[model samples]
Target: MSDYLPSIYTKFLAQFPEVAEAQGAVAQAVRERTPFDERTDRLLKLAMAIGAQAQGAVKSNVRKALQAGAGLDEVRAVALGAITTCGFPTAIAALGWIEEVAEAP
Candidate 1:
């Protein structure tokens, strides 16, 4: 696991060791199979999260995207681009989710 994982994720993994191991295995497989760089992967995941209207996932991926060297505009673009497919309201909600983390102190 990467040192960059959020504390909440660590706590959840600690609380559910079986799920943690499975998650680790799946993550490793995805990494091994994908050719995209970390930044692209993060952004792509963020877009998916946006489409799903998953608030926590949107925020989490935004943080990872920034850690992977994505700029604010790049992150914002992902949310904006989702507007077409996810609809205006869902995309707007995702933007709020993104901001919750991006603007954190």
Candidate 2:
């Protein structure tokens, strides 16, 4: 666990020990896949997390997206596609969350 794990995440980890293992597998798989792009599958899934109002997943994916070199513009474009696919409200809310994560250093 790097400094990237925010306090919010640490608080949750007290209850979900499995999160670490699951995250490791997901990270490895994601790293083995195509590079981050608005057209990529991971981008679509990130949008879905937003649509589902999954805060934990959204935070994790957004961090992963950034680590995978997804720029804010690329992410916003993905969110636009999400608006089309997952509907307006879900997409907008997710966009907000993604922006928060992407802006972080």
Candidate 3:
């Protein structure tokens, strides 16, 4: 629903409205079921995205985390902490994506 969402994602959402609605419902359910607060949830999502090597997710979560009041250092820390679990290259790539989003106007 964001204007900034990637074109491919927007196209998918447009092409499969039902699927998009279901996905949104699932995401909402997860948010309601989770014990973590918004910022923590965003950070956790960022970590998961990093582990999955999903650049789009990493960038998206960085923006979401910041919007949820997470600090820049906190965002950077999440990417840095992934190095051990996700390997140096993946972590570095995630960090680059994080910076790309974080530095964007």
Q: Pick the candidate with the highest lDDT.
A: 3
Q: Estimate, for each residue in 5-73, the C-alpha lDDT of model 2 and write its tens digit.
A: 767767777777798679878967886775656335556667778778787677677776666666667
User: Which ranges of candidate 3 are over 4 A from the true structure?
Assistant: 1-3
Model 3 agreement with the true structure over 1-83: per-residue lDDT tens digits = 13287888999999999999999999999999999999999999999999999988888898899889999999999989988
- Better by lDDT, candidate 3 or 2: 3
- Error of model 3, residue 59, in angstroms: 0.9
Candidate 2: lDDT of 102? 65
Model 1, stretches more than 4 Å misplaced? 1-11
TM-score, per-candidate, Cα-based = 0.87, 0.64, 0.93
Tens digit per residue, CA lDDT, model 1, 1-105: 122556888899889999989988999999889999999999999999998888878888898899899998899999899888889998889888777786676
Return the TM-score for candidate 3, rounded to 2 decimals.
0.93
Query: Best TM-score goes to which candidate?
Result: 3
Each model's RMSD to truth, in Å?
3.1, 4.3, 2.1
